[model samples]
Target: MVGGVKEEYQAAQELLTCMGANVVYCGPVGSGQAAKICNNMLLAIGMIGTAETMNLGLRLGLDPKLLAQILNMSSGRCWSSEVYNPVPGVMEGVPSANNYQGGFGTTLMAKDLGLAQSTATDTKTPVPLGALAHQIYRVMCARGYANKDFSSVFQFLREEEGQ
Candidate 1:
């Protein structure tokens, strides 16, 4: 459910419906933002986990393409691993294939993760991974990859490991 000012909510619902989005009214003013933060937090975690797994596979003598196929067909499968692989050449027409450009930027992802962390802290939620993901993105930003796609975390990790 999308929560907002009544008129604005109705207008938003209409626009979303027109755009083929399945719109539902969530609750109150901040609920939509809350949902968005939660989604972004999970997405961040998935992307980071996928990157780490791919890197580990590479270090263990697994071919990137074969490893990706294995992961996609197994329990390790995720949107990041199957659809938007972080490793270059494993997929085509994604941010990673384009030098990590023109996709969700690391700075924006960091901001979303920060929002999730703030909300989690306020609610006393034990979001260990979310907090860690926030720190990782913060470090990425500090190391000059803020403008790159968030999946570029793979690159950051690879470089740090001298891979």
Candidate 2:
């Protein structure tokens, strides 16, 4: 998403569109960063939730793909579940399928969550879940998942279980 003065954003959007970017003008200056921070914070939380749910399903003897499909068709549906499933073997072309090799790295996600946490603190906004997600990602980064895709939280969770 683009932000800042509308005219300036329009000019930038024209150039971005030339490169086939699907950009949206969010609002004033800093709005784009705000949007990204909010989005990544929620994405981190959703991915964690998805990983937890998928782990539970696996331990319950439910097939990962089938459980993912059920979630996609139900109220539990989210991008993490339907698109970037956290469970290995559930979806192809995602980091999870490739052993969490390529995609948004855990360190990057932890950084984004740090931004979100800082923003929330500065605004005096309550973000209990976001804070928890931030801590989780921070721990993930410290546990040797810094370069792995954030979806590797699934593996992180699994390892934690083993301990």
Candidate 3:
């Protein structure tokens, strides 16, 4: 997937053959397409998880922005935090808090997650989390916010009423 289309598909087919697996012709185009779907799905889930975790920190009164600062300065922060910035206002220039716009699209993510689920079922692998993630994204896409970024997952946070 990291390589160009031709290489990725060839690699997939080669791996399958090496493992004595059989399937229809999966060329570079196919591999690239599959990866596009899979990566976006996972990306959406990561965005959602990161947003929720940061919200949890806020509920602890850690000051999301401050906590985010600490994470960026510390090892606790990851790509979603350090690079993606899911808390919206925490990073001063991210999409999280601002209605989760200007980020990855929910529909794209749902499409990929759907592929992932299909793969899991075909392989008979345990991917309940992936399945659930796909379901959430499917619902998210069905909602009117289909135009927002994946970080729009923070919408879930705004909905939680904490008296």
Instruction: Residues 17-49, candidate 2: write the lDDT tens digits.
Output: 886667888999999899999999999999999
Clashes of 2: 0
Highest-TM-score candidate = 2
lDDT against the true structure, per candidate, is 0.93, 0.92, 0.69
Name the lDDT of candidate 2: 0.92
lDDT of 1 by residue, 7-85 (tens): 8887677677886567767677999789889989999999999999999998999999999999999999999999989
Count of backbone collisions in candidate 1: 5
Give me the displacement of residue 25 in model 1, in angstroms.
Answer: 3.0
Report the C-alpha lDDT of model 3 over 1-163, residue by residue, as the tens digit.
4234555555677675765554444344456466665666567666767777787887788887778788778766667778777666766556765667776777777777888888778879887777878887777777665787766767755554441
**Over 4 Å off, model 1:** 5-11, 18-22
Residue 156 displacement in candidate 2 (angstroms): 0.4
